[model samples]
Target: MTDVVGIVIVSHSPLVAEGAADMVRQMVGDRVPLAWCGGVGEGVLGTRLSDIRAAIDRAWSERGVVVMVDLGGAETNSEMAIEALPPERRRKVVVANAPVVEGAVLAATEAASGAALATVLATAEEAGARCRSVPSKTSAGRRQ
Candidate 1:
């Protein structure tokens, strides 16, 4: 079986993490294993540090996991969670490059079986930059 790619998005708002998952679902469907962390909403992604860490462990146990954070605070929490895991688990847990929405998707998608987390993270960073370059549609384009 193809190795699963675990994902975690940490942001100031949990919605951002959840939204990333929603977008991924729309683009790639849920065939690949995915997870989320951080968010203020009730049902939005894993909230507590322990939950995030557990998800990472679970995902990694199945295959491996990549964690992406939107900002310093989120990154700190995510990092702490990962650090708290057992040494063996740390090998499976990756602190993703630029840990943003765009990066997470790109990394997760590009990652094949047992690929190094750093490689996927690099792809994510590059993809995020590319995504930023895309122009958004203006209100004038559609009748509202």
Candidate 2:
């Protein structure tokens, strides 16, 4: 596996980001390049632009990179970090719209399978909607 698309996890809590990375690492092994930034820094609870930017740089890949964030501030800060990049490189960074932990797992799987940026992004974005707890959904809203 080439591990084309990289992953970055951002959260207001350092432990959350670290734990999510650990989960993705356990699921995907070393097939995914993982980077993350969390906390306000210095034992505080908040997200910082510097931390997000550093994570982006660390996880960057020529193929592309996807970032999964915990909340609004994380998302906003991640976007700002991407925007700070050169215009050409900005598009390479995508902020995913999915649950951080689950999305990271699916995205890592897709990337490890040598999927392209779009496919990886699609998998992450769609992960939250994937079958969970039940086998399948029926038109009548019953579990199949």
Candidate 3:
């Protein structure tokens, strides 16, 4: 568990980030390092690059870290955070395109299992498919 990748959740709402972190803890317990940052000063529903950077620093790990963002602007800020890291450390981080809640939960679980950084990130990315409508069956009952 000590070597597993950590997770950082960046949301437009502080409550959402904290709630997602809470749910992730429920599944992964204390095995994974989870950090979250949301809302600008005074509870505004906005993401601040500095805040995201601070959260990533808090969740830093030797194994790597995966960041999940809930909005387009958040994603842009997340990219800036990654770019801010030294070149050597940048490769170890990824900004997942997965939904915040599902991605955080899946990432935490994979990390707790001591999965490598790539695997943990892949699990989180795959979680996005879960939100898709169920596969439709053709007349032959084969999934579309």
Candidate 4:
């Protein structure tokens, strides 16, 4: 069997992250290991660094982890979690560009295993471009 691609979405609010994950499931049927961390929803919330770390650990057991954050706080926390992991484990984590929904969906729907992380990232970035939130000057920043 092919190795699965793990996806992690961290947001300031778990509701939003869950919503994104739900959208992916709606589209892709949930075969992938998708993990959501951040603010609380039901009983699964990880606002603290430790919570985020645990969530990542849970998601990164089999294959690699693809992380998507909603804002600076979530992004920073995810980054911290990855940095704190052992070098070998840390290699399995990937921080996505933006629009976790699009990125994760594209990653989950492709030939990602046995390939370089860069290839997966490229696929995600392309997916994000396809779902670009209205052409704006802000997008220009990406060129720089």
Q: How would you encode candidate 3's per-residue C-alpha lDDT over 44-139 as one tens digit per residue?
A: 787888998889888888899999988766788889989998887789889986888988999999999899999999999888777656321113
Model 2 Cα shift for residue 1 (angstroms) = 9.6
- Once fitted onto the true fold, the runs of candidate 4 whose alpha carbons sit more than 4 angstroms away are 40-46, 111-116, 130-144
* Model 1: residue 135 alpha-carbon error in angstroms: 19
Please tell me which predicted candidate would have the highest lDDT against the true structure. 3
Residue 57 displacement in candidate 4 (angstroms): 1.7
Candidate 2: minimum summed lDDT over ten consecutive residues — where?
135-144
lDDT of 4 at 81: 88
TM-scores, each model vs. reference: 0.72, 0.85, 0.88, 0.75
**lDDT score for candidate 4 against the true structure:** 0.67
- For all the candidates, what are their Cα RMSDs to the real structure? 7.9, 7.6, 8.0, 5.4
Off by over 4 Å in 1: 40-47, 112-116, 128-144
lDDT digits (tens) for residues 47-72 of candidate 2: 88988888878887888899998776
Question: What is the RMSD, in Å, between candidate 3 and the native fold over all Cα?
Answer: 8.0
51-118: candidate 1 lDDT, tens digit per residue: 67765654453456777766555666677888898887777777764537677667667664345556
Off by over 4 Å in 3: 132-144
Model 1, residue 134: what's the lDDT? Answer: 48
| Candidate 1 lDDT score at position 131 | 56
Report the error of model 3 at residue 108, Å: 0.5
* Colliding pairs, model 4: none
User: How close to the true structure is residue 12 of candidate 4, measured as C-alpha lDDT?
Assistant: 62
Candidate 2 residue pairs that clash:
none
Predictions in order: lDDT: 0.63, 0.81, 0.84, 0.67
